[model samples]
Target chain A: MDAMYQALLAPFIDFAFMQRALAGSLLLSLASCPVGVFLMVRRMSLTGDAMAHGILPGAAAGFLLFGLQIVPMTIGGLIAGMVVALGSGAVARFTVQKEDASMAAFYLISLAVGVLIVSLRGSSVDLMHVLFGTVLALNDAALTLIGLISVVTLVALAIFWRALVAECMDPLFLRSVSKLGTPVHFIFLALVVLNLVGGFQALGTLLSVGLMMLPAAAARFWTVRVEPMCLLATAIGMSSCVSGLLLSYHFSLPSGPAIILSAGVVYLASILIGSRGVLSTRNRPSRHRTA
Target chain B: MAEACITFSDLTLGYNNHPAVHHLTGTVAKGSLTAIVGANGSGKSTLMKGIVGVLKPISGKVAVKSGNRIAYLPQQSELDRSFPARVVDLVSLGLWPRRGLLGRYRPEDCDAVSRALVAVGLAGFEKRPIDTLSGGQLQRALFARVLVQDADLILLDEPFNAIDMKTLSDLIALIKRWHQESRTILVVAHDFDLVREHFPQALLLARQPVAWGDARKTLAPENLLRARQFHEAWDETAPWCGPDDAHSHHHDGEHHHHHDHAPDAIHKGAA
Candidate 1:
């Protein structure tokens, strides 16, 4: 027992980097998991995925200009994400193309452009760092950025909670009563962009949305209500971060991928054993009966 | 005469500059209960969209009485039924115009939501997720939300589709109560029998005004025939004609106007 405890706890307790990685991951999860729930319920999960990939080119551009500075990369990621979101939306609106098709086209182009830019000036090591993230090497500046973004995301979400839900449920009804429809939608997208930007530094552009969407999708199997689902998703996200960090510390695994794989494991477990999960039918009352 | 709550002056409503409803002129009096009856593609929903400011008129004017709050119940297909929201929370959104975006919900607001749920026979369903409710029950829940809204003008678009008869009569009673309160209510309905029995005024439309007045007169068999015929005669290949040119389609003799603009003639030389 003592050997197991020491192996599991010592690295986090002794190494400051592991502690920072855990804290940074927790903060990112806390802010973004609820946004993920909204995205899932709004059927924008793919949109979230597209936005995550869309941030890569911007972050890569920032990397090309400023190496690996946190602020420039964050700003670059934010601009790229917003441009993709708004651009795809505009393309869908003006042309016959659907939103998902437009988003797919934009994100594929963004990923290619981002990779080309990184390869143009930087080496394979820099490309791996940007694409896969360096969770264990988070500095104080990165920690502060994550903390600041978490606070802002939570605050904005609280203020716009009612409008966001209403907009998602019945936009036409909302439009008839009030004029907050468009503003709420844009603000919600901005929140998604901000969280993606924050998550990019810690989880990398490719896997950042995993910290959001995986826990959210997992939480859906546990509860039907919005508030509980959000709370459960947050808890699931935090747990995944801690467990993934410890696993990466013990084994020689990549931190970001380990964290996402941890979330994936939880999601798979939830799908099998959660209250409303597929394998939980024995515990659940039958949904159909003879008339 | 009662004051006009809504005045449509040659309003042309459409999509991509192609008018679905053209040269519409009428008035919905304050405290009137009016039914807008039309065939499937005859622009009933489009006109409602115009009135609610969701769609702009292609030309002319739709002058709603200023400062009068509007409540609209669109088709169930338009709602995101899978959204995760409790009946109480969804109903409380009716207070949006009053509370704006971030106002606190007082105890009275809670009481109002409860009262509305009771009014719609959904008192105990406050905690139920909207997705769990039956079709009739969902319509009832939406009506509860509209009750909480307390708007002066209420527009209902096909509010009775797929609902049970019990729910239908109950909703109609609520509509009557709103009518008694002197609110202007406009419903887009397919059932002419229901309109004649309940609605005092009617606007029978088929891309244009077939008749608008007393339900008994406006919903006569002759007018209903005209509406159906007009809808059937609509030129799918008609060139994109603006509101100015649409006037030529409606001649003084209704019979002649219907026969003159054959589908082929409508498609040719209107650009």
Candidate 2:
């Protein structure tokens, strides 16, 4: 028991940085996994990824201008992410192209520009830090920011729960009864951007969206209702965040990928063994009953 | 005449500057049941959208009586059936017009949702995820939502297509009940015999007003044929035509030759 405790709980108990990392990631998972559930149901998981990539250039630019200050980098990322989200939406509305296509095109440009900006001034190590993140190096400000974002997200989600679900499931019906659909959609997008910005501090722009999407996707196989799916996703995310940090500490693995890979394992297992998963139902035939 | 619930004055609704519904002038009376009848893509759906304020008129006005609540059940295709929601959750959304955003779902409201589900033959199915339900069951659940909405103006677009006979009869009975309650209701229906048997009023369209009023007369064989011909003869690339140009455009041989019978070609004062 002591040995297992040493392997599982010692790092966080022994080191201040590990505690901070655990706290920061747990807060992030609390907010983002719920948002990710909505995105998965709305079939906008790719849009979430694109928005994450879209933040790269602005974060890199902030790093360029202010040399790694969280405030400047966050502001830059938020602005870039909003631009990509809103700009692609506007283009899709005005032009003949669909939102997914427009988003795809814009995110590619943003990703390329972000890489170019980072490479122009920084050494490879600096570039690595920006791209892969520094979960172990989170300071007081980063943790505070993640905590604030989590609080705001949970509150906003509580308020917007009905309208957001209605909009996602049956937009035309919502529009007919009330005029809240468009504004609610904009607010949801803003929340997504806020969470992505919060996530980038720990997971990096490239990997931040993984934390948002992977557990949510996995949760879908286990539950049939939105609330349960969201709760399950959060559980999966918290477990991954905790275990990933431990694995990183013990095995010398990069924390962000380790966390995401942990989620990947959950997703894979769910795909095989979840209630509605492939292996669970395979080779089983049941007699049909009348309603 | 009864007080007009919805007044459309030369209303032209469209997408991308191309009119899907053109130059409609009519009034749907208060406390009346009207069936919007047309061929496929003949603007039956568009007119329903316009009345519910989903589609803005490009040329004219659609004046729905002020302060009236609307409950609309669009075709099932418009809903994301795979969404992770139960029948109870969906039906409860009908309370939105009453409870609104951030309002508590009171015990009474929960009772109302339960009653609606029962009314629509879905009492025990409340906990079932919507995706697990059959299409007909989904439609019944949608109707249960409309019941919970208790709106003054209700619009149902092709609500009965592919529905079984029992579901159809149950829904028609619900519509009749709503009509008796004096709600302004419009249904888009494909079956002419059903519309004639149930609805008192009808509006026929072939991207323009073909006829309006008296279901039996409006859906007469001659009128349906005209709607079909007008729908088939449409030029997909034709530009938007104003009221003045619409008459002449139908006469212009370069666009289409069959519409030259000018007197029969226009229903200038028919509604």
Candidate 3:
């Protein structure tokens, strides 16, 4: 038991940076997972992925302007993500192009621009840090930013819960009743961008949405309702973060990829043995009902 | 006759400015039950959307009585049925206008939702997710939602398509009850027989008003044929003529026959 504790828990207990990493990740998960669940429910999982990649240019711009500061990077990322979200929507509405195609186009451009900007001023090591994240090196400022974003996300979700759900399910019905339809949708997107920006520093641009969408997708196999699914997703995300952090500490692996891989493993396991999972045959006795 | 609840003056509703409902001029009377009947592309749904403020008229005015709340039930195809929501929660959304966003559901609100569910023969289905419901059951749930809305003006777009007979009858009874309460109801329906049996007034439409009065006469064989002809003759590639240009075209001999006879046909139905 002592050996197991030393192997699993000592790193977090003894090292401040490890503790900070865990705290940052746990906060990121709590804030982002519910947003991810909403994304899944709204069938906007790919949109979230596009937005994640879309933030890279903004973060890179922030880095160019303000050097590795948390506030500037977060603000930059938030602006970029919102622009992509709204731009894609506008393109879909006004032009013949569909939203997904427009989003893909915008994110690709953003990714290229972001890489170019980073490569111009920063070293390869610095570029790697930005792309893959520095979870093991979380400063107090990064932890504070994560914590603050988590609070904002939770509050926003609470306030917009009913409106958001109604918007997703039947926006026409919502619009017929009140004028909050468009505002609610934009606010929800803002929250999504906010959470993505929050998760960026801890998980990096490429892998941040993985922390969100994977746990959310995995949570679908375990539950049917929204609330329970959100809670379950939070659990899955936090566990993945903890286990991934431990693996990184022990095996000298890259923290961000390790965390995402841990989430992937959980997803795979859920698909196999979860209550409504693909491999769970309890719900399906035969191809056709016996009746 | 009661005062007009909804007044449309030369209304032309459309998508991308290509009028789906062209130069429609009419008034929907308060406390009256009206049925909008036409061919598949006859602009029944588009007119309903215009009434509910979903679509803006291309070049006309749709005036509603001030302080009169409107409840709209779109086609079931418009709803995301797979959304994760209990039947109770979905019905409770009807109270949104009164409660607004972020308002807590009071005890009476809960009671209203339960009463609505029970009224629709869904007493024990409060906890069931909407995705689990069948077509008929989902329609019932929607009707339950409209009931909780308690709006003075109600619009339903093809409320009975693919619905079972029993559920249809129940829904018809509910509409009758709303009528008894003096609510203005407009239903878009394809069942001409059902409309003649239950609705006193009807608007037969095919891109434009074919006839608009007594259900029995408005659905006349000649009018139905005219509506079909008008629908079939619609030019998909025609450039959107503005309201003024549309009026000019009405004077031209080719367009004059369809435009000139509409009100006369309506008057014939009234007489």
Q: Choose the strongest candidate by TM-score.
A: 2
The true-versus-predicted C-alpha distance at residue A94 of model 2, in Å, is 4.4
What is chain B's TM-score across the candidates, in the order shown? 0.89, 0.88, 0.88
The DockQ values of the predictions, listed in order, are 0.65, 0.71, 0.64
Best by DockQ: 2
Model 3: fraction of native contacts? 0.70
- What TM-score would you give candidate 3 relative to the actual structure? 0.91
lDDT of each: 0.85, 0.86, 0.84
Which pairs clash in the backbone of model 3?
none
Query: Per-candidate RMSD vs. true structure?
Result: 4.9, 4.3, 3.8
Model 3 misplacement above 4 A: A93-96, A279-291, B233-271
Candidate 2 residue spans exceeding 4 A from truth? A283-291, B231-240, B243-271
Q: Is candidate 1 or candidate 2 better by TM-score?
A: 2
Q: Top lDDT: which candidate number?
A: 2
Error at B177, model 3, angstroms: 1.2
